[model samples]
Target chain A: MTEELNARDKEEVRQEESTHPGRSYRPDVDIFETAESLVLRADVPGVDESSVSVRLDDGVLSLEGRVSVQDYENLTPVATEYPIGNYLRRFQLSNDLDPEGIAARVTDGVLEVTFPKSAQAKPRQVQVTAG
Target chain B: MTRFRFASPFDSAGRLLTLQREVERASGNPFDAEQSPSGRGVFPSTNVFRDDDGLTLRMEVPGVSPADISVEARENTLTVSGERTIQIPEGTSYHRRERGAGRFARALQLPRDVDPTNVTATCKNGILTVRVAKSENAKPRQITVQAA
Candidate 1:
């Protein structure tokens, strides 16, 4: 069952990749899980909350962040150590997550997304009865 | 062995960058006393660029506040140190934590003798751009072409 779900998500991700032809860089992401929620953090420098957009549709979470500008009219970039481009990445959500409950925030160029787990999906401690 | 190392296609660009910097250092020119980026536990990647003015060091430190960061320059070494404080909500817990938490400090050598007083830094978006003006001799000045 897990494999089936993952494969489906992978297909969606592949579709997402081919759809965008413009230059897009993948933001480095960190994902951690707790008992009740899953947290995702992406390193997106040169982007603020206004330029970042998060969307969830049918278990596919798409994260897109655009850099306001890469070149300047007067200042010539003699040497560029880093590449400037938009960021795009798509993630597949499983049934265990509540897609409708997903929330995100951008702080200091870092985008954090929180996904709350469904009640039935959360980890629970089973009580023991002693006779 | 080298060919096998690049089997994974995920981070080929990053690996290529390191290799390019290494090649430049191997050439070993007078100006090549490279003050390269020594990324040691630095949150985001770093880049050091040199121009006629002096040098510019950029570090991608997302989520790190300007107040928490400190920079010190002595001789030719420029050290940038900072920490990103992790704030977990009161009633919430993290399931997956990919972004590193806690404090991190990274220091690197500078390419030229910079004017300490002239150094300026600005944090935009999440990138910290540091400009170190070159010393008097290092600054570009063209001598008058005498008509012989």
Candidate 2:
């Protein structure tokens, strides 16, 4: 079973993080695999549907989300923790996936990308002849 | 008012989650659980920014409805709190769970007093934004320069 994909150590992502020009962050993602599809759920707070961009090139899936924090001219900051930035992540895919069938949607700050398996990869039950 | 909690033998996993949660919760300010306004922890990572107009605080609390979140502004302290419960599909099993869920709160003491009556807050796409107007006295004013 390829269940090891779900147990991927977060440190691996950290190590894979490449230096980007602007302020970008690696969002937390959850991957679930079923018989027919592989689903990726990424948490990218402050980003809405219009600002998110998804691209697949050369077997690599890239998700980029740009979030602009609202500003209040009259207010001043007393404390800060997280800073506003973009969320970017890339994943390498195998040929078992049908890139043409991938679907994505962003809702309530979570982005879901579903990759359907190729027709040949799905399990099939063969018919037997009656004796 | 006080309450007591006892550990269950089979709840080791739950206990471990709680222990790890405590480490992050302590850095952020603490508050009472029932709809308490913001906590100081980084659980719901937040950003505090202010301009000449007012101050805005943004927090990441995905999957949480606006009704589940509560915000309170008093004097110089602003608190944000909410509960985010994980709703797992009945037939589906979770092979991995990295997202943190539960009731959380954090309170921040701003640099200046804010007008609680004029404050506004909105939650969309799992992010919470609060805009607080500074008190009249706390606002910056231009002083007349005498010609010397």
Candidate 3:
């Protein structure tokens, strides 16, 4: 009975490790800040444009997607280090972000998120009045 | 070796021998193909360019998000790694499958000496572009001559 319990515990641990490898679902991100907007780029291989979802709930930005590996049945896979699971990521947005105008798109496995800065956050030119 | 012979009509034991041979050759390794199973573990095709200002590296990685990629530079090498996942819908049968999954890693050696501290990466559309500024020693210098 003890041996069986130990075997089951090992299997559970393996399954947990495979599902959540403790790494970021999206491993790479590039952030670019410009005069008017901030652009974010992420690498999400094996996913399609349609499979990606981007949402802003409250002040948090979340990105989600899925990658399926149903193909290549004929060629046996000798080894794989990648864990398959639902990709998830979240970011806290600053007050300068214009959430209403934020835009996102995915192409060729890369996702780009553009956040336009609010008018109040942009630099303003102050005029001087001569006395 | 065992041999069999066919005899003439009048004399059944008279002989003409027959021989047979079989040849087998192993198939080519699948890794040579552009889209092999293992190939999915690395980033797709990429292009690198160098100019007076900096170096640019572009990789084709579709369907990924900005949060999914990671880039790190150590010594003279830059490493890019990421993961992509897909789920098959229930009741769907796949006729053909080509894309690969899991974690992928790609490392590149810069053509010119770069200031690792000033490296930047940008992704637009489906291309991941990494720009690294060249070190003073690696940048081109123009020399002027003064006539005496």
Candidate 4:
């Protein structure tokens, strides 16, 4: 089990290294799973719905886009803390995702991705009959 | 009627010019009337990801249609620009306007090298997603090391 976990972790690191080279800007993402679908919410500041993109291909979910900083250009800088850059993040989706039926939307800088679980992947309530 | 005057020497017009100068000084970019027309009071945001096969970009922009958005890729920069016009209901005064309106433009520097000609974008559910296929040189190639 430990070996498997380590292998998975290594694969994740390799995946991340391959996608984003230097800058690491991982948007905050929350994932919730229901009986029918798995929903993912990502918080991307300074991004409009028109500029974001979400896609899934061959079990790999790729998200790429930029965050516009139009208003910050005029404000006087008091202190700098927030790491500002184009937002880029990736997730290696499991086989449970229904790639064809996945849906996504962005509202108020919040991106919501809904992945309906495959019929076989969903938990089944078995009915027991008298034997 | 008599008016009380402050000690400041500049009039309202002068004060406005001073404020504009201050703003320009604070911001590295000079304030241009042309740029102002393109600029809206909204922030730009984008999401990026990649799987084993391809890369995807999801941008958040509400109240924009596919026809209104324009995406162009030149060299290393990918520009996404559009205008979002929200028509407030008649006779309704907005007490609090949080979401921004008007025109917005955002450009992203893709992390990985891609085939500029093959990039595709789709707008659905108010989210614009641009997918760029990794070029043959950029994609990971497996090295078969034969035992020497």
Angstrom error of the Cα, residue B25, model 1: value is: 14
Q: List the candidate 1 regions with Cα displacement exceeding 4 Å.
A: A1-23, A32-38, A68-84, A96-102, A115-131, B1-44, B50-52, B90-94, B142-148
Report lDDT (Cα) of residue B22, candidate 3.
Answer: 8
Per-residue alpha-carbon lDDT of candidate 3 for residues A19-64, written as tens digits (9 for 90 to 100): 3232224435556676677777665655567767888999988886
Better of 2 and 3 by TM-score: 2
What's the best-to-worst order under TM-score?
2, 1, 3, 4
Compose the digit string of candidate 1's lDDT tens values, residues B25-103. 4322212123335412234355555556776666677778888788777766666767776666556554444555556
Best by DockQ: 1
Model 1 reproduced share of reference interface contacts: 0.28
Instruction: Estimate the TM-score of every prediction.
Output: 0.63, 0.67, 0.41, 0.39
> Residue B117 of candidate 1: its Cα lDDT?
60
**Per-residue lDDT of candidate 1, residues A1-131 (tens digit):** 11100000001122345333334567767777777788888878878888788998887888988664432212234333345556788888778998878899888888999889999998788999998
Runs with alpha carbons beyond 4 Å of true place in candidate 2: A1-20, A69-78, A125-130, B1-41, B74-77, B87-97, B110-112, B139-148
lDDT of each: 0.63, 0.64, 0.54, 0.56
lDDT of 2 by residue, B2-26 (tens): 3534653324334333433332333
| DockQ score for candidate 1 | 0.16
lDDT of 2: 0.64
Separate clash counts for every candidate: 9, 23, 27, 29
Q: What is the per-residue lDDT of model 2 for residues A90-123, given as tens digits with 9 covering 90 to 100? A: 9888789999999998878888888898999877
Find the 10 residues in a row with the least total lDDT in model 3 chain A. A2-11
